[model samples]
Target chain A: MLRSLLEFSGINPLRLRMSWVSASEGKKFADVITEITKELQEIGPQQSYIREAV
Target chain B: MNVQKLKEEAARALGRKDVKYLIGYKKGSYGFRVSPAFIEPKEDIDQLIMSPLCNMSLVKYVMMEETLPGLTEQALKPSKIAIVARGCDSRAINLLIEEKGVPRDRLYIIGVSCQGVIDQRKIEARFPQVTEPAEVTEENGNYIITVQGQSHTVPKEELLAELCTVCRYPTPLIYDKLIGDKLAARPFHYDEIAAFEALPLEERLAYWQQQFSKCVRCYACRNVCPRWYSTICSLDSLSPQWLRRSADTSENFMFQIIRTFHLAGRCIGCGECERVCPMNLPLMKLNRKLEKDAKELFNYESGKDPKAKSLLTTFHTEDPQGFIL
Candidate 1:
């Protein structure tokens, strides 16, 4: 719900990312891109739904 | 039955040369309030009492002992502080141990089998302007309260704290001495959070906005959190401040998220944050939501074991990559 809100307000959900950065894993990036893409899809077409919502 | 035996056991523990003190509860000056008592002598054991009013989580003071500033030279070592801990308080101890915040040997915990504590707010609401000291005892199905020389039989539902509704662990997981009969653990339920989430997105945002606006940036929630005792909190880090000092909607939102995220896998569901919040924000809604997510996604529960690592800190090779890629 919150991601959609930000995305609807023209803020890129992809930009406002939350990642679990491990202190031990300094440079592990095997799944960073995939995670970003997945989050983007979840933030789907919020402009229409959010407008109706607001 | 168990209360007296518990006192005898504590007195025995205190008699030992190595034992420093026994922490217990005593009657407070006001209605439905209990204060922590540090008993070093056998006579002081009589002053301790446990009732529905003894809702305080004494695990916080385990790390609260006064320590000297910055000098590597030690004048004295840490004392073994024995405390009366309930289920939730025991979890705090476990969390501290998990984070290496406190050594296990240094703590002598007298664990109590908790029967859900009363919500002081609820009781106060039902009996406002109470001047005299009062008592709340659990009976067959109701709480018998004696306030101002009048006895009132209140329904359990009216005085029970919301966290008690879904508590799955009523008895302490770890203890050196035990108190009270072990009650059966209840099941976890997120009915309140689910109901809140059922609201429309706009309404949900509005509800949160109203709640967040009332926040005075007192940091009471942060101060009371057992998991948030970093010498330098991330919120105060100037190198790259994640949250701005300004108390605007954006900043408040960021602060809340940051606080919740920090406790993603570390929150023990003690409800201390909600209890200490002066604004009375439904902060637990956010926390329980994250807790529910962490449970579903990782199959993990925080503070279950001291040796267990935090979810964020520990990752698996077969970690779900579907979310990112």
Candidate 2:
């Protein structure tokens, strides 16, 4: 729902990625973060939704 | 349609030993304005009026009455509060009762089968510069609006509130006594949201950016929400200051996102927030988006059952987890 909202508001929904990580799953958290970072790098900076930039 | 029956019912409710007061709509001071009238005595029941213009939800006043101080321990006994409820207002009351926000035993809901209320702003814009008090009567799909000695007949659709346009429940879901003929529920449609969703992500963002930028941070949307009746909203708390007082687009976006998320699966599509917003923000779009998602994802429709637990409050082992990484 948050992703849909962000997408509707013109934000890159990929900028936000939710992963279920239990306290004991430190390796899983690291892997999730690394994957998100790679995706962000592929997507690059967010486009300006602010009117001034447009 | 029958003001006499409404008055009699209100008078009867007020006459009850347990009922403290009856909260309903009365005529406003000027054109197209209807104020919530509190009727204490049975004689004062004449002050109450029911019409398409009585769009403001009375459920908020019931919540406000609960939070007011100075009630003695003896006075705190579950006293009944009689409210004139439209379909949406009744739903709000049911949702409140379901969430334990208000006790059902202490409420006397006089439900009115609504034929949609007129949007006050739309009427004012159509008949501008009318200083005198106006009267609007719904007759056969037309609104006979009389202002400053001039009468204009306008199609109901032209001035009907947006919420009413797609209202699935026109009759109260739960009521002690219903007044007037019950209206059949309208078929729900999401074509508007679907069309918006069909647009490219950037375009959708740009559209919302313009709307969010117009926000002055008045918090009228939050104030008018029936579900957002928290005594101390986290957004307004000074200790944490979850939201700053800034009117910048980013801050406004954050505020809106938080507010909408909090209302997810709880909002009954009352559209009061969108109706009361000063910026004329398309808040219903955001709310309805969540509503649609909740329906599709969980088969949940809010405010329908008083006994059922809220969507976010309950979890199922068989719940869909495809969205989770």
Candidate 3:
């Protein structure tokens, strides 16, 4: 629903991704993270949507 | 609808022993404005009026009234309050009851069947500099507007509020006493949201970015929301994760988008936020998009079913997992 909201607001919904992996399955977690990171690289930073208040 | 009949009903509610006062629309001080009138028992109900110009949802006032616990200066709070409701306002009341904000028994609903309301800005723009008080009546797809002893006819489509154009419900869903004829509602439509969805992702972002940039961070949109009067409102917290007071794009987007999410399954599409917005933002776009998605994806429509649990409140094992991997 969060992803849907982001897309509705014109932000790339790809910025949000959720996955479920067992606690012991470190390999599966690492693989999922890498896949999301690749997708984020293509989608780029949500530059227009987010500017951290730093 | 007969104004006299509405006034008589208002008098009846005001005369109730438990009802503190009755709230209805009265003629505004100036042109094309309708003010919410609070009536006492002995007061004249003749002041009450309902026309296409009464464009706001009165449900917010019922919630805001609670914040004024001792408004009457009496030791005991008023047991019940009477309010005039349109179709959307009735929906809002039901949503409030579903959220347990206000008890249904504590309210005396005077539901008025609404055909549509006029957009004040649209009408004012169309007829600039009409300082005199104006009156409006709907007649056969046109508005018979009378101002300063001159009557003019304008097509309803030219001044009808945007949300009213696509309203699926024009008759109040709940009421102790109903006034006027029950109106036949238009079938559900989300053509605009569908078209917006077809646009490129970047284009959609650009469009909303421009709109959000125009936002001054005036909380009128927040303040006017019927579902916004919670004890622990999320965005105003001192926590770093919450939205700050600044009017930058990041903060504006955060405030508007996050607020929209909070109102996901509760918004009745009253168009109050968009109407009260100083920047004239298309605030309804975010709301209607979610409304469309909730209907299409979850088969849920807010304010349609009073007995059913709210969309966010209830969960099912069969809920869609397509978004998750």
Name the weakest run of 10 consecutive residues (lDDT summed) in model 1 chain A: A45-54
DockQ of 3: 0.71
By summed lDDT, the worst window of 10 consecutive residues in model 2 chain B runs over B69-78
**TM-score against truth, every candidate:** 0.83, 0.95, 0.95
- Which candidate comes out best when scored by DockQ? 3
Of candidates 3 and 1, the better by lDDT: 3
Give the C-alpha miss distance for residue B203 in model 2, angstroms.
0.4
Q: Itemize residue pairs with steric clashes in candidate 2.
A: A9-B205, A10-B205
Q: Write the per-residue lDDT of candidate 2 for residues B68-144, one digit (tens) a residue.
A: 77877578654888899988888898899999998898899999999899887898899887777788899999999
Residue B85, candidate 3: Cα error in Å is: 0.4
What stretches of model 3 exceed 4 Å from their correct place? A50-54, B69-78
Clashing pairs in 1: A34-B324, A34-B325, A35-B324, A35-B325
The chain A TM-scores for the candidates, taken one by one, are 0.42, 0.76, 0.81
Interface RMSD for each predicted structure = 8.1, 2.6, 1.5
DockQ for all models, in order?
0.09, 0.50, 0.71
Interface RMSD of 3: 1.5
lDDT of 1 by residue, B205-267 (tens): 667667777777778888888777777887888888766677765567667766777777778
Residues A1-54, candidate 1: write the lDDT tens digits. 234334322345465655666767656553665766677788774332121111
lDDT of 1: 0.75
Return the TM-score for candidate 2, rounded to 2 decimals.
0.95
Better of 2 and 3 by DockQ: 3
Ranking of predictions according to DockQ: 3, 2, 1
